[model samples]
Target: MTRLRLLDATRHGALHLDRARGGARRRLVPLGRGEIAFAAADMPLCFAKDAQTGRFELVALLALAGENNLFTSPAGYHATYQPRAAGLGALRLDPAGADGLAVDEADASLGGAGDALFTDGSAARWQAELRAVVDDVVAGRALAEVYARRGLLRPLRITLTMVEGDGQVLDGLYVVADAALAELPDADIVAMHRADELAPAAILTASLAQVERLRQLHNARYPQQIATIGLAVAD
Candidate 1:
């Protein structure tokens, strides 16, 4: 049996590994979102050596974002956290070129404080927990105190759920960049929003499955269009 090897993102780009084939093998492919685009880029990945093959197989803890970030909706789509460009509070990315946005793989200052990242074993559970924390934060809870207790750099999981919205129940995770942006009633459902505009939209992003409940609703234009939602710290 092959033991699972863990990899952390030194810089944000796509989660990729240095394959034995002399080329990089992508683990979690980035969805071109601005904030996480740089942070998840070309970082040094760590892994354990395979005793039999005498090689390292690296795997990223996070998953890649799906195209359009759209999922199935029966009662119509409810609001979820929308992706946006990184604002003032957004985590900064390393310079790609000598003066560009690219991160230098050789930079010692990169990957500062590896403690901010979670290992593969706990990534999924942590993601769900982060979403719960966001719910508390949205409901008139203090972010500073919560973050201080839990620590920041929270990872989020994009999910689809069945909940009431304007008398209609939608099956998908509805979130916003800020709690103030949410127009839905507080009692309607849990609204997961970010405190800062600069913070990455959703962490460990994943696309919801297309609605396949009834055959009559299986139309070509069902999913609508790809929304410009941004994501952060995808699993």
Candidate 2:
């Protein structure tokens, strides 16, 4: 599985990414009016905006190729993988499934006509908060501090751009409010279900503490829509 992250560098006109594990570093090239930067999962990329550009919002999308890629060879596997249509029907159902389930679509546009207020929020602050969570997870520390720092009543949006196993693009928007670690299951069973149902078992079980924390936060705070995306935390 591969995860993708998009950072808003328009504010500063430049963006920088550093891979947490491979030590691969990237500096942005010039971007046009509607451009952004992308980072892949193997690389725990983090970015900062250049001070020379005008204020702009940074948006991130974490995309993952389905687990258990059938082919052994990278070339063969990639060749076999293709984007397919993600049936919107499954996502549009009302709040009633076998287990009292419900599905709703997420708002994926960065800042369309009515999203000016939300777009004004700074990505730098969110990036810093995520960095802290990453740092804590790498050290095997608890995420209580990070959870506490977030607004208790406000929901935070986390965007995801997924290319399903069949190759259809699934754009997701996750709004996280409060989060807790796996040890504290009472804090978020719904979130756990979302993680478990959508992600591979091995991936969920091996996730960093911070990943669980984010899930918990999203479950607790999100007012609408179910979260199907989970972060792959690397050491």
Candidate 3:
């Protein structure tokens, strides 16, 4: 059971977050634009819609090859790079709203010993770091909204086929397809560049290569249920 409560110094001053178990089993963690360049090198960045707003947002696949997280294991959580969302543990903060920070006391990570959450009637140092991550997420989404308005996004069609027969197609996800970027007029490209979006778009296009890496890792790790992944660009 989850016991979510507003973070009050009197209530949670002594509570700390356990880093190791914070984002342990999370399969899809949101990535901010600021983390893109770094994360692209470590994991595949994908786009999925927010369930509530139905607007596109960026997510990092904790496990690319399998439904289970590749970043975590029986031994322990071992991701090459940690997403900012992982640092939150059971904490939830609204980037758009003022003054409502809550934490799930139910989370194992939020327990007696870890890192102090509150110091002197206010959020501790870690909250500042996480708040910055939240701001980056908000800023990144603003840029993504611009990308959608400019028609830079296309369906990132992922085909899942069995070794012997037909399989399913996952097309709800979207991407900044390379071809779509190419189709943009030089003027538009220049404008995007001037707006500081050209680089991230390129990064998103380049990140698709990681999909095959995920498949290879998946095939190597789980031989019993192997998957063949494929991508297609829409015309």
- Residue 93 in candidate 2 has what lDDT? 18
The numbered model that scores best in TM-score is 3
Q: What count of clashes does model 3 give?
A: 0
Off by over 4 Å in 1: 1-67, 71-82, 86-92, 96-98, 103-220, 223-235
Give TM-scores for every candidate, taking all chains together and pairing residue i with residue i.
Answer: 0.17, 0.16, 0.81
Q: Whole-model lDDT for model 2 versus the true structure? A: 0.24
Runs with alpha carbons beyond 4 Å of true place in candidate 2? 1-6, 9-122, 141-235
Residue pairs of candidate 2 with colliding backbone atoms: 8-58, 12-53, 83-167, 84-166, 84-167, 84-168, 178-217, 179-217
Comparing 1 and 3 on lDDT, the stronger one: 3
Clashes (backbone N, CA, C under 3 Å), per candidate, total 29, 8, 0
Ten residues in sequence with the least summed lDDT for candidate 1:
82-91
lDDT (tens digit, per residue) of candidate 2 on 1-235: 1222233234322322211111001111111111111112111111112256421212222122322211112222111111110111111212232122122213121122211211243334333433443343322111212222332112223233323322223222111232323334553545645544212222222322223333333344334323454442221
Model 1 per-residue lDDT tens digits across residues 104-167? 2332222432223235422333334334433432331232222223222223343322122112
Per-candidate RMSD, Å: 18.2, 21.0, 3.5
Any idea how many clashes model 2 has? Answer: 8
Cα deviation of 185, candidate 1, in Å:
25
Model 1, C-alpha of 229: deviation from truth (Å): 20
Higher lDDT: candidate 2 or 3? 3
Whose lDDT is greatest here? 3
